[model samples]
Target: MYDFTTFVQSIGNFLHGQFSPGVATALEWTLVILIYLALYAILGLVLVYVERRVCAFFQLRLGPNRVGWAGTAQTVADALKLLLKEPVTVNKADKLLFNLAPFIITLAALTVISLVPFAKGLQAFDINIGLLFIVAVSSLGVVGILLAGWSSNNKYALIGAMRSGAQIVSYELSVGLSLLTMVLLTGTLQLSAIIETQANGWWIFKGHVPAVIAFFLYLTASIAEINRGPFDLPEAESELTAGFHTEYSGLKFAFFFLAEFVNMFTVAAIATTVFLGGWMPFHIGDWAGFNAVMDFLPPIFWFFLKVSAVIFLMMWFKWTFPRLRIDQLLKLEWKYLMPLNLMNLVFTAILVYLGWHG
Candidate 1:
């Protein structure tokens, strides 16, 4: 059997030896950034198409299927249209910051991917502080949103930006606290190490009640953080008319849309990594036959499946729920989720101390 750990280490070592330290680091970062961009493009296309199909199915109507083999090329056509269109800048807008905002938001969305582990032994940095780095960087998107809104010099844009800033800042605490419970149980911040720690069992199962509660809290907070559905006051079409990007058009608008989709996937992927065992295949306790069957599946498949499931759940919630008022949103986070997460963390710590986990 090929030793996967050694293979990953060998690849890392080879890259290090093949280039100077600076060059190697640059190359690694370049590779990660490129992957992030590529995935952002692909997922945006796929998600748009998928959302259409899902909506059609729910409404019992036919979806896009005429463009290119069941409408597969529809997104491609949309891309070309956007590329050919001119980006319009609003009157009195700050030209420099107006143009810079989309790039900043996109970059912030892409940066989070570096810390996400796609499969066993497959991560970009695998830094000891991977979890914290992701949380910190992911939150920076709010700055870009605020900049976009303020720079537009439009009342609606300013309102959208303000809502986004408040929304993300409020929800991020719950998300961080929930993830902290997992880190405490696993005793590591590296995504790879956290996954490895779950080799025997997923934290969701191994940590029992606390893990379950944290998972739900993480889900709720992530929804608000990404500004999806019920929490999407920043872009409430009925209210702010496209939110922070109200004044943006053409490719600039595309950048914001792409970043939002990528952010959604990133949140789902992180949740899978922290609580759902990431690329680790499902296995029952000491079931050799079951494990053997599970092992036949590649690690990436497991990782993708888990992340996809989380995305579907989010989408379901989005379609089924009504938007919350800003005050209600904050109250849910601070009054309820924050306190509950604190208790969950303490309970998890006690469980760990009591030798309740594997």
Candidate 2:
């Protein structure tokens, strides 16, 4: 396998040898930030195109097939329009937090993406407590949403914000618990170590029913957490107008919109790392030829393949299901997902203790 880490290390070494340590460090960090920014922007555009085309496929429509080869440039064009529009401020809005809110959510999305392990040496932040870090940082986006609503001084916006706050807070429990189930099997908080443990087989295959339950639990909670359809009470068009970001327009609105797709990607990437084996390719036992073929693809290829699969599943849920009432959404999480997740965790722990999970 190609060692991307070594290649990156070699670049860093060359930079250090060419300049003072502080300058080299600063330059390296600048390069990293640039790369992440490019990725963040590119993913936002690409994902928007993907979602449109995918939903169109489901609805039997043409989607974005006109602009720049199958509507590839459609999102870019829309982004430009939003950028060129005038940002209208609410007459009575709190200027400070209202302006700050978009950055808060956008920052949260960008920060969480840094923790994901894209390939063997592709991760930016490989912290010891990466899972905990992700949960904590990702939750911060709600605070921004709440602030956006309250600072806007709009009733509909406030309502949307409150709904989002409640939804994310409640569903986060299920997210943590579902990931914790696999933590027991892997016994590590590091993302890379978790992937390494799955080199033989993914937890979904090895941990049996409990792991499967946890995967679905995570999937369901994550959809709600990101405020997708079915659980998107915060921005339900029939009820709340534009929801938490109703007062936002122009670039501010674009920031909020971009953060959403980025957050979706972050959630899917985390799911890939935790439950779908991250960058590891699928391998059947005692099938060297088949395994070798799977291994022929790069780790990054496998990683994004799994992530794309998960993202498509999320989009399917959005297009297929009807939106849930707020009460029903909360009930589904607190009553069903939460309890089932707890039981699955207990069962997984028992299996791990008995050495029967394999």
- Which of the numbered candidates is closest to the native, going by highest TM-score? 2
Query: 1-358, model 2: which lDDT tens digit per residue?
Result: 9558998899899999999999999999999899999999999999999999999998999899888987899999999999999999999999999999999999999999999999998888899899989989999999889999999999999999999988998999999999999899889999999898898899888979988888889999988998885788888889999899999999999999999999999999989998899999899997999999999999999988999999999999999999998899889999999999999999989999998866
Worst 10 residues of 1 by lDDT: 1-10
Query: Over the stretch 1-358, how does candidate 1's per-residue lDDT look in tens digits?
Result: 2236687677658889999988887877787678767878998888777767766766688889899998889888888898888999988999999999999998898788767888766666678998999999999999999999999999999999999999998888998999999998999998898998999999999889999999999999988998885899999999889999999999999999888888888999999999999999999999999999998899988899999899888888887788998899889998999999999999989988998877
Residue pairs in collision within model 2? none
Q: Once superposed on the true structure, which residue ranges of model 2 sit more than 4 Å away at CA?
A: none
Relative to the true structure, how large is the alpha-carbon lDDT of every model?
A: 0.88, 0.92
Candidate 1, residue 66: the lDDT equals 90
TM-score of 2: 0.98
